[model samples]
Target chain A: MSTWSPSASRDALMARQQMYRSIREFFYTRSVLEVETPLLSQAPVADPNITPMQAGQRWLHTSPEYAMKRLLCAGYGDIYQICKVFREGEAGKRHNPEFSMLEWYRVGWTHQQLMEEVAQLLQMLLAERFSTLPTLHLSYAQALQSYAQLDVHHCGDQVIARHGQALANADLDLDRDGWLDVIMSHQVEPALPHNTLIFIDQFPASQAALAKLANNEQGVLIAQRFEVFFNGMELANGYQELTDAQQQLQRFKHELQGTQRSHDALLIAALEHGLPDCAGVALGLDRVLLHLLDAQSIAQVLSFEWQRA
Target chain B: MANYSSNEFKPGLRVMVDNEPCIMIDIEFVKPGKGQAFSRVKLRSIRTQRVWERTFKSGESLESADIVERDMEYLYSDAEFWYFMATDGSFEQLGASSEAVGETIKWLKEQVVYEVTLYNDAVVSVTPPNFVELEVVETDPGLKGDTAQGGSKPATLSTGAVVRVPLFIVEGEKLKIDTRSGEYVSRA
Candidate 1:
């Protein structure tokens, strides 16, 4: 039989309790409503990029984003949920087939406002537990320029090609976003603050999947999107909601035609049900715990992984 | 002349890349948020000990290598080569310097059969069995109160290979060792 120490088990239980308490208290203070949604749905998310695990001829809900948005249209206003999400073929040090996700939505809030609130909540939560906070902010264009020396918004495909050539030692086969992500993860992300949270905002319009677009102070068109990264690990992705049903349909179709290329009848039906104007974010809870506990792999925090399961 | 697709690829499955025998090492599915999907694979050249990477568009097909395996008996080792006798009563030999054989030579016994990998009629590699039982030849005596966790001691095997064993394990005991990771499993 394997040996287990009482002290280690107690510490783990304490951490889990604190995490739940912190989340509930944060939402309660903000006056955001907590709600539960169905784990299984007749219709799956239509975006081809995400594959839903099948359960007895039905699809597992990839995320609670769709149903939560329907509630917003029904006038539920600000809401958040801590729930389980499933995605196939996403196993790694940072990924799992099944995982815990903390998703929140804000009605009438722009993507920028949501980004600010996420940063504040993270800072407050970390401070409560660790007695210190680490956070930084950067524009997506600035991050690319600082690490890769290429301005993603203003640069052409040729510039990306040149960057790929320079990064040949990384052993990455060059494609547009592949090259960009390689540079970001390898060169730029590692150099960010380790003790502080780093926020990368103002993504290019093309990379913003479901985010709205607006002209910043420089009058350059930028997507209302932001990402939270801690110690080179991506923890959360948030966006300013796109309210135009026609534009949303076009974006979904564009994603479907691309790599994810699968049709979702449910998402289409939801569109027909009239989705409301709202902003939402999906955070990877396991990744956050990895950073908080200074663990190397998601398997460490999970009770059991795919191999063990 | 059938084409092999990415869906049919797995470890130890040989495939022809640019008419050369290359074995897949690590295979991953990578695709951008936009654009075409591709399978990224790291392959090792069988002839030369060089490693390289390649990306194939999803659903693309390639030729599979004509590879096979044979059972051979170890005969003896000379200064410049190690010789083996095939089950078909044919004697085949390969140039294996002491360094090339490395620790595996210590475990080699006469008349014992091993699986040898061949690519295009050329011997490429040898794989030892997962578990091997060997007797310990030398180690310090176990001491009382050494039962604390995370304790280990060096023990030399009869094959002249020294490995770390638990403090409680003594010399002259046969133990099962994992060949792949070189770790002690249990007393045989």
Candidate 2:
């Protein structure tokens, strides 16, 4: 067995403590109530795009999202939680099988309002940690137009397929959303303002998974969600919740049919209990630490990764 | 013939390109988020000692290289080529163009075991010992109090290889040097 010395591990543990303390302090000062929820749930929400890790027939919480929304329906106003989440096949420089997630929600807020709050909160948190803050803002449509030379809001599947083929001579069979994600990561996200935090907003309605949609000035339906990125790394994702249970059910069913997975009945029951109109976001704690400390990989901030475990 | 996919690629994997045996030097996973994932690779030609880059899709397959590595003893080098004797008492020679051998020729010595790579039964490249111990033949005498300088001086070895030696080192001293990076190592 390879033995680990205390000196290196101690330093890492101390840094983790400092990061947790900073997060709590930030929320406390903002009057956001700190809450704790179960890590294991009888039935967890299922999304085709995200697979949940099974723990002995029970599902480990991929994100504290579903239960947190249940709390919102239970009359818990503004609240936040920093907890552990798990997903399989997510081991890499930026991902781990089990990771720390910081999620927060606000009542009576639009997606734009949530975006402004996230930007300010990040600025305050980073300034206290590093003594300097970097920030930038861009709309999703603007990024797609500038980098892919195609407006994602208006492009069809055929146009996206042609663009994907032109990207590399090799055959690439990709759908519209897949092409958009590829172009965003490779061409747009990397070219964003890297010295500071960048906020990407105004996503197309189809990609809104759980977020609410609103009509823009151009009559295009856009999701009320924003993603925070730093130095080409995705740090956080937030949404203005859709409170209409019927629409929520329809969305869930669509996801199930697309991925061919069974519906999550418990989440449906939670929705039946009535979720209030609110906005929430989940941030990657390890990725935030990596950017703040100028570390290369999320493993550097983590106490023990999957490989090490 | 069995086809090898890029997804099955790893270090030490050998593939054939244009009938030449090439070994993968590095494999990088690069995929655009929503598009076809690709493995970008750097490969070295076993026969020509040339390095080139190629990108392959995830499911694409490649042919294996017909190359072998053999241990041989270095014999001698003439004006045109360097000679080596196989374990079976057979001799094989490779043209050691100055550019091809680069700075490695300085460390070559007679009777030293070395790795010889062959492609299609023809010698392509020679790998010298990763580390070599050599005896310093000539150098200026160490000056008084110069040991405190912590600097190095030039010294010629018995193999005619010039290397940097510490001020405290003198003639007849043995030193280890890394052949790959051509850097000073330590006392033998």
Candidate 3:
């Protein structure tokens, strides 16, 4: 392997730069203020799965979620940031330990509106390849039924057991949300067609993370969250903001899997000070670039994936 | 043998699964947003020659397969068993399982030794030289003056592997064949 050379070609790199420039323009037209946040924090995220790279007493930021939310609480109406975030033990065709993320928050919009905006932005960015890319919406239940032919809410237990049978270990031990994610990521995401913006929305309430929960027309409690997948890659995840201080604290605890961080208290305080009703999202910029280039691996769009770095 | 953590996973690594030694063929890291991470992997069992997919929770460890690769030459088989000898003159277990021989068994030409992969003292795989010269043991008589550019016919080699060769090639003619594909390369 030529480690000395950049992972992406000069032409692809130029396209990336152009994509970045166009993204800024897209937000600028909407009057979304571009903002920057600290790359490291004194406290780590409780989300046990996302192990943050630590530097002595401080930990590198996983995503600008908490800090960006703090900004939202400080009354920064519509803001966006494109920055590099760090996560440990993630490397492959699509993942690098460190990757670029484009995060933004809107004061008066819902995740649904944000999803439409995302589709519009993608169409703007990929105008050269696609004249008009159609956006497809699928509720979490519809996605499972369409892709794996299983019901996420009703037949969850049996589906997990059957899905686990294929695994080497830890079969059927995971919770409902865990099984949904495993099946969704491995099956539904990649099977999505090219040039279509697929929005898988209304997640299970248990896996809500920081999103707000509401009942769908079917009366099942679902989280107001949606994920965007393009050309078989998960490009972005967004949520209708959760502003209840107590609820936010509980979600933070649930995210920490087992680790505890002092920032949880600070975030709770911010929520108590009142984060405005808003929707927010963090998109993987590298993956978006990969989709635009129609490249098989994320390395083709990134200047230096984890390997080269 | 040493154990391997999920972070150390890569292609070509051998690890035991359910007491059978399997080689890691492909692996991809998958982590759902804000959820448990997993390494989806594909493995081929040397004992059964069955390729299957498996998933492991991140941070999980695997037992080493105690596998080793050595340069060896293919020896004649005893009908039920195929044998090979290392370049250093050391004899292998004297019998290789059919599963270990794989499809390469069709191209196994005696005296044309190959590099063999072993696990726990049993031959699990053999790699033949890219090109091997074998006499065509069976084929229709060449059409008197058929040139190499004309039609082709099936020819059986000394290894019993059939390959399509130029119409000019007839029985008893030595031909070079690609062991990997069991295809005719050229007249030797």
Candidate 4:
């Protein structure tokens, strides 16, 4: 009756609790140690696209990625964390400024191997609610070609921008990667088949700094990152960890130029100390619950959305 | 002029686009995995009442449009303009052009309160109430038990608006009409 009450229903709260339990059980069976890190950090992410929420002199950690990598460097193998992540000004029907994230790392695993584990975990959790769906994997460039009829790797900026403009229905001033992102979200995502788990990997090299870089069979450079989508919702993102300290610092510096943000010195130090070979993924728990309950908005699964919080 | 960033956009927010005042009818925040965020919005031009969609990258800003809305009582209509007086006891009179009144002119009734939108202190649009009561001036006599057949005939209201009423309706009867659909609701 009043705004003081939570936006989630009683049943939704129960479903959320059940989801957490399932996630923890999944990791426990795999022997992945659960870890916790401080929500407040001394340094913010250097990614220009993400804005960190500041509290006094410190910033809220956008994700537990940095700290978890630190643990890996310190010889903690196969770690998982379930925590609340903060991103400023990201509220919408599917987004909340503060939302639950389930991040984990697997030692001695490739991004492709990690994808299988992710699919297995999702199947276990969504078994009772949804029917079994065949998991499909497609490279970013292949997905673009199949759905939008454009080659992301060889296409010129004008070609990509034209596609972006046609999908957005207006002219946009954007770089090549920005226009590719627009097409991925506007055209490729909506056109993805429903009732299926789709993973789009081999992102443009510039799009992912933390992920390792590799060349496809066509000899085109691409990032070893993948995204999971279901029912048109972006559910998770993952990477084959980049371990070279110097290369990592260069990427951070390149991204921080105009962002006016500082890179995490401790994270760099951890990389310098030798982070073990690993692959990691971060999944939006709230969004996963939205799919489980078949709800329309993220607020229906969150205990208190941004406005209420 | 004040400016609004993409994050500040929401439904009913008025902003300037292409040097024209438009209102945001819907906004959706979309971000691809590990990419820049964007705000997809549907805006309706105030002057032309035409709606179109646009996408703005995060942090992109737009100039704000200063607009105001108020309740006014309909007074009378001239050849080129319809007159109204402020209902807030100010007794301030304003004349809105025929373009501003648009299709609402068909439902206009003297002394009825209507919403008036002003841009730069000039009337840009008028909205009639959802339901208006008017007396039927012309219709055939009511047919006994015709309600069971669900048949209806045309009736003309005192405001010169025509609507379909049930066959049981007769002339000179007060009826509630839905201004949006021009259909008879019930006896007022």
Candidate 5:
């Protein structure tokens, strides 16, 4: 059923172009360099859920994370890229297999600092269409305790199933991590203020993908990471850089390979070459546009969705 | 009897949960960028009429509900059982105390057909047609020269339904009532 017409309307397509211009203008004023890297590379994502598409013997770059980190090691300082990213088995109202990503890194900044900058960018974008949203800086531990009434470090599966309406009648056989994910995704995220920008920081260490571990004010270990949610959609995730090569390798093995080392030697080597202390983030550009345009689905804003493409 | 994966979940799907039949009322797909995807659903219990949310991990399978719906003609109810006949002339029976027929028992009329939902070969629930014509069993005498918009008064129908009809509508006059809303539609 291939058609000649574009999925989006003339006005929406025009709005998309205008939005891109605003994003570039936002970064340009800050002197953050715009850069581009190869979309196809041999390095694959350690996150198993993001299966990269194969092109000959190479793999499609999942997020341009590794290559961007390499540039940081070469003393490129702060840089940003807006490009298409690929993932597999993810298709729905909020997700598409291929979508645009707004990824950037700031040299000499902590995850907390980057989170403040992210808030400024989103507030700037939302101000153009909707009124400016006040940022709600909420710790992940506090959100669960307030909304779900469970201890983050010590909560069990039974408590989560009985906690909120999201998993109110969930199976008692679910694991601890499984229950946490369900509660956070459905219960906590939705209950956050819709007209406000939400920043949830300090996640469980088990979910720390590439982030460095840090001690919270309570002397408990937490990942130096943060996620942003707006209008009931997860818009971005950021992490404090993990600079030690040995520890980076260990984390990749634990997170991706199930206790086995991966074939990705390039990222570790780049870390060994001394990546400057920095924080980086990746945001879903399509989802952001959906909220800005008051559209229900990502397909409405995009020129063509996966099925149409 | 059948199986469905979380990816197959949608509204109006019936699935068995914890040994009781339930129907899915709503479903929303929630997935993380690098973690398990879950189908967040709202399910209404067929027996209790209670609705609650459930989250199923992607690729997880659920047993399809052993529920069936058919066109059944209403038959007389003995003290203990409400009987109905299928179009093929087969009789089906449900206990009067069964959850399916709890509220429907009040609006039932003799010899009227209904869309009956059955679970495990027993009647679970019945839905009457959207519009049913029933004679007004009780009403005040009509005033002279009353038209459709003059006024409306409460009239009791043969199926134990109470509706507000125009002032010209009197006892024994057939009136069309919207079964879903129990409102007067027009003269039959």
Candidate 6:
């Protein structure tokens, strides 16, 4: 194909447009107000795993999470935004350096409540290709135990490393959270049930990015976060917002350690100004469209993939 | 030696793993939305030719293997080592250890070009041509008009590699042999 040509077919692009319209309609009927935020920000997210693309003096926002949360703090209720997010060094069959993300927040909602809403939207959007199926809910610990034979809450670092190395078939030098991430993405995600929406929630506390910490039924501390998947591919990640400003600042500092970057002080300031309790989720729109169109690769649904762009 | 981070990993890149030179066969970028990133790679060991998978944390660096492949003409083996001369007009001769020569020694033909893989100036492996033309050194005499039976018999090539050829094939005739499977193709 010529370099000027787009990666997706004309038909695929049209389908994507239709999906965008359907998403807007879905939100419109529910009275969820749509909003926009700047793509570039003075400060990027503090999560070291997600690298933000730099543009001149500013960095392209990895997500509109901070800005959207600031809006929620400013008294915007039940808001949604569909925008392009940039993450450096992430490109593959299912990922691009720049991709579309649909993020939203609901006041006084928990991650569990947000998960049900996500299921409703997905069922409505994918009605043409699939019949509505029951959503499956599994805790992060349950997934690790069932798929990788890992007990994340109770296992030592060596045990997690052993399972990860065995699954990868080679040695892996990783920390506890690193090994857990490896097993989760490589083994557990692929082993989840297909043809239905699946929610894996209550992650280990160390991995809780912007989520509140809560005690589970067994009195073990867990992150109030959840991820949705279909056909073993992760589509969305949701979190019950951490309303404590001091705690949020500490978490950001912990993540930004060993890096030269600083946290988003504006977001922390907004958190301190009496923000209401909320839950938010960010969904990868390209992946959702890929699944809706039954496409094998994300590029097949993108007008111009990173290579062509 | 130069180093490569996980972000630079791709198929066909050779890197040192566990003190051995291994070539990457496949690579996949794996990361959770809010967790650590990893690069999962499938690699084949240069010495053992065994394939396995390994995952590396993002930003982790690996030393690049100083490996090179050269076109060389097979000379002869001296019990302990096989020798070859570079075909690049340099006429540089190099001796390969018995382990490096491995099973490809059975397909070695004098003056025939083959690929010699070297790591850090040491011969690590050799690859023979996919198809080689060799004269049959030993076989039963062909029976006239025996082609109709469609029977096959074992014929020893000049390189001492035995292959099954049609019953009509006669000794001293040059035949095309597939080096990979050690099977006869047809008369050269």
- Candidate 3 clash pair list: A46-A256, A47-A255, A47-A256, B73-B113, B74-B113
Model 4 lDDT tens row, A1-309? 238889999999998889899999888988999999999999997878888999999999999999999999999899999999999989999999999999999999999999999999887777777769779999998899999999778878888888898877767788888888888888889999988899999998988769999998999999999999998989999999999999999999999997768899999999999999999999999999898998999999988888888
lDDT (Cα, tens digit) per residue for candidate 3, span A1-309: 548778898989999889899999999999999999888787787776678889887789999999889899999889999999999998898998899999999999989889989888888887877788999999988987888787777775776667745543446366666666678778877777777888989888887878999999999999999998888778889999899998877776666644555545777788999999999999998887777777888898878777777
Stretches off by above 4 angstroms in model 2 are A1-9, A128-130, A155-159, A162-169, A258-260, B1-188
Instruction: Show model 1 residue runs off by greater than 4 Å.
Output: A1-14, A124-131, A165-175, A185-187, A258-277, B1-46, B51-92, B95-118, B125-188
C-alpha lDDT of residue A284 in model 6: 96
Q: For all candidates in order, state the fraction of native interface contacts they contain.
A: 0.00, 0.10, 0.67, 0.76, 0.36, 0.76
Model 1 chain A poorest 10 in a row by lDDT = A1-10
If both were scored by DockQ, which would come out higher, candidate 2 or candidate 3?
Answer: 3
Ranking by DockQ: 4, 3, 6, 5, 2, 1
Candidate 5: list runs displaced more than 4 Å: A1-7, A48-58, A151-168, A172-174, A257-263, B32-35, B44-50, B66-68, B71-99, B106-113, B118-123, B140-154, B164-168
- Residue lDDT tens for model 2, A1-309: 233522125566676788789888888998999999888877655665456777886778888888888888888899999999986545555667688999999998876788788877677556645566666777888877876788777768888767755554334465677666656655676777666777787888877878889987889899887888878877888898877778888987887775545666666677788887888888888877776667766667776666666
Between which residue pairs do clashes occur in model 5?
A: B100-B124
Clashes of 3: 5
Where does candidate 2 clash, by residue pair?
A182-B34
Please report, as a value between 0 and 1, the fraction of native contacts recovered by candidate 1. 0.00
- For each candidate, report its DockQ versus the true two-chain complex: 0.07, 0.14, 0.58, 0.62, 0.38, 0.56
Q: TM-scores, in order shown?
A: 0.68, 0.71, 0.92, 0.91, 0.85, 0.89
Question: What C-alpha lDDT does candidate 2 achieve relative to the native structure?
Answer: 0.74
Model 2, native contacts kept = 0.10
lDDT of 1 by residue, B86-172 (tens): 766666654444543445665665676766667766666555567778899999987767756468788899878788898889989
Each prediction's Cα lDDT score? 0.71, 0.74, 0.83, 0.90, 0.80, 0.89
Candidate 1 lDDT over A196-251, as tens digits, reads 77888887776676788988778889888888887777778888877666777787
Q: Which residues of candidate 6, in runs, are more than 4 Å off?
A: A1-4, A126-134, A167-173, A293-296, B135-156, B164-174
Worst ten in a row by lDDT for model 2 chain B: B29-38
Taking chain A by itself, what TM-score does each prediction score?
0.88, 0.92, 0.94, 0.98, 0.93, 0.97
- The 10-residue segment with the lowest total lDDT in model 6 chain A: A165-174
Candidate 6, residue A124: the lDDT equals: 79
Q: For candidate 6, lDDT tens digit of each residue in A1-309?
A: 348788899988888899899899999998999999999999977988899989999989999999999999999889999999999989888889899999999999878889999999889778877877678999999988888876789988888888877776667667788778878888888999889899999999988888999999999999999999899788999999998999999999998999989999999999999679999999999998898889988999989998889
Runs of candidate 4 with Cα error greater than 4 angstroms are A1-3, A169-172, B135-150, B156-160, B170-174
| Ranked candidates (lDDT, high to low) | 4, 6, 3, 5, 2, 1
